[model samples]
Target: MSKSEDIVINWARRLQSLAQAGLTYSKEKFELERYQEIRDIAADMMAYKSDLPLAKVKDLFCNETGYQTPKIDTRAAVFQADKILLVQESDGRWALPGGWCEAELTVMENCIKEAKEEAGIDVTVEKVIALQDLQKHSSKIFPYGVLKVFFLCHKTGGHFQANSETIATDYFSLDNLPPLSVNKTCVEQIKLCFEAQADKNWQTRFE
Candidate 1:
């Protein structure tokens, strides 16, 4: 996406966040109506900019009523020797084993759960590799902001099983990776994981 497109998405997300907060706190009828209008405008902007249906954009971006915050995603970087673990998604592209962090689970727990569910592996969370702003790494425009936490995990046990999210799982060398699901995981992130793994005193990287 172009810089101009990125700016439009940023503006829409900001308007949506403001409107969501207003809807959550303001009780006055006229003020509520105004907030709804702001939300509609935001939804429209998102729909047009993203080439999504207006109703779908509203459902994804405007349905939630709260003080909007960046969503947390947990990814596990599990390596064996020189190879890093990656799961082939249903779409046939690979990504690290992870997904949206559940509100009920701690970040580590969410990372563990995603590793088990997506790649069918048991892992011990070693340390955080990075805490990244998704927009900085991906060109994909989302309705809201996302903070992706990559945990360097060590595989303990377990074998791959049939799962809905991913079709297969395997370890791939850093220099020989398959096509990636960029929205979920990117080449730069994989490289950082390898760098962190090699350095015993690696500092946690953050955006």
Candidate 2:
């Protein structure tokens, strides 16, 4: 990552850590409110420093009452017989099976759950394919902040089942994946997943 990207990520991470700590230790509602105020202040400071608009900064800081940690986005690339599983997104575009990671679950567990929830398929997570920092990529969909983790998964059970988040699921050869939801997943990244699976090496990439 470049120096600017590193700086932004570090500041964002620190803000999240502070929010998590506050949520964990504060006993009184007033104290928790104070911590949230602090978190907002920190996020505002980052926005000012990074030149992000004020509204965007506020959105980044907003979270559930007791859940203040930075959110993780998890995705799984399920490959079978030289074809990769892809889901048709709500926006009428095709992408991988994944979504925002819940705080209650591990990264791998979240990956599996997303596959089932979005594509209606059971999958066994094999290894991490790559990790990408969204801020560095200038994404409008995630204008606030996000960190995405992509995992290489293998089909374990069940057939394709589309959920509310997706319209349909299908497998495509590497040469034929439709236009992806870049904010969620990218074709080049999917290619990396394929390479990692073929090499049997759990490689990780960062932006």
Candidate 3:
């Protein structure tokens, strides 16, 4: 995105945050109206800069309550031999099996659940291998802040099977990967997971 577009997105995010806070804490009706106006303006900014419909953008901004924070995305980096597990997503590109963390879901539980749901595999989360801020690593501007959590998982059981969001599952060597969902799990990050798996010295990387 251009610097001007960045400015618009940043301004819109800030305005949305401020508006949310103002709406949450302020008791006065006039104050509430002003906050609502701020939210509408923020949504307008998003709509003007992006292809999203204004009404959808408005709903995204206005539907939630309280402080907005980075949404967590849990991922499992499961290895079979020297290959990594990658699931064919609904969008056609492949990615590590995982999604938005549900209420009270532990990292291991979420990882295991996602593995079963998307890849039809049972996994035991070995450890958290990486924690990343998606905006820092990705070129696309995500509508909400995202905190990506990747786990090095141990495969236990189950076979490749299709699910609602995933069409297929397979393991691929690091040297030869399938078309990847770069927005979710990229080649560089996948390489890091491989390295971490091979060496006990590999430390958890964070951003």
Candidate 4:
């Protein structure tokens, strides 16, 4: 992001934090009104930059009630025939079969569950390929930060199955890949997984 855009996002995050703290603790009408105004301004800033409507942004922001936290995303790069498994998403773009991690599961379990749920296949997670902060490494931007963990998984069993979240599952060669769901999975990250899978001496990558 440019310096100006970074400034805007920083201000938005700061204002959101203050508003949350104020709304959580203050009961006085005057204080609540002022905090609400801060939040409204923050929403406007975000909406203006994103080209989204103000109320839409406000609704997206107002639903939270505590300190903002990074969302956790997990993905698996399951290799077969020197190709990687991916599922077609609802939007018609393909991504590694993964999504938000469930709080009830360990990160490893989450990776396995995502593979099963989104790809309809069983996988044994072999090793961590990378743990990255999405905003830092990815060109794609979002309203909130995300911590993405990419795992190298071995297909243990089960055929390609399509669930509500995905339509079809297929393996693609790196040289001949389809359009990616950039927010969840990207070509660069998938390449890293391939590197780790091909070379046992590869080290874990992080940012």
Q: Which number leads on lDDT?
A: 1
- Kindly give the stretch of ten consecutive residues in candidate 4 with the minimal lDDT sum: 136-145
Off by over 4 Å in 2: 1-60, 64-69, 141-144
TM-score of each: 0.97, 0.70, 0.95, 0.89
What Cα-based lDDT does every candidate model obtain?
A: 0.93, 0.75, 0.88, 0.84
Cα distance off (Å), candidate 2, residue 75? 0.7
Task: Tell me which of candidates 1 and 4 scores higher on TM-score.
Answer: 1
For model 2, what is the C-alpha lDDT against the true structure? 0.75
lDDT of 4 by residue, 1-207 (tens): 677887887788678778878987899999999998888888878887775677877776666876667779999989997999989987899999888888898889999998988888889988999999987766543556689999999999987666789998899999999998877788888888789989988788987
Instruction: Give lDDT tens digits, candidate 2, residues 30-139.
Output: 98888777777766666656656867766655544554434688989888888888899878888888988887999999999988898888889878777777655543
Candidate 3 C-alpha error for residue 120, in Å: 1.0
- Extract clashing residue pairs from model 4: none
In Å, residue 58's CA in model 3 sits off its true spot by 2.5
Q: Model 3 segments beyond 4 Å from truth?
A: none
Tens-digit lDDT string for candidate 3 (112-192): 898889988888877789999998888877567889899999988988777689998889999899999999899988998
Better of 2 and 4 by TM-score: 4
RMSD of each: 1.0, 4.6, 1.3, 2.0
- TM value for model 2: 0.70
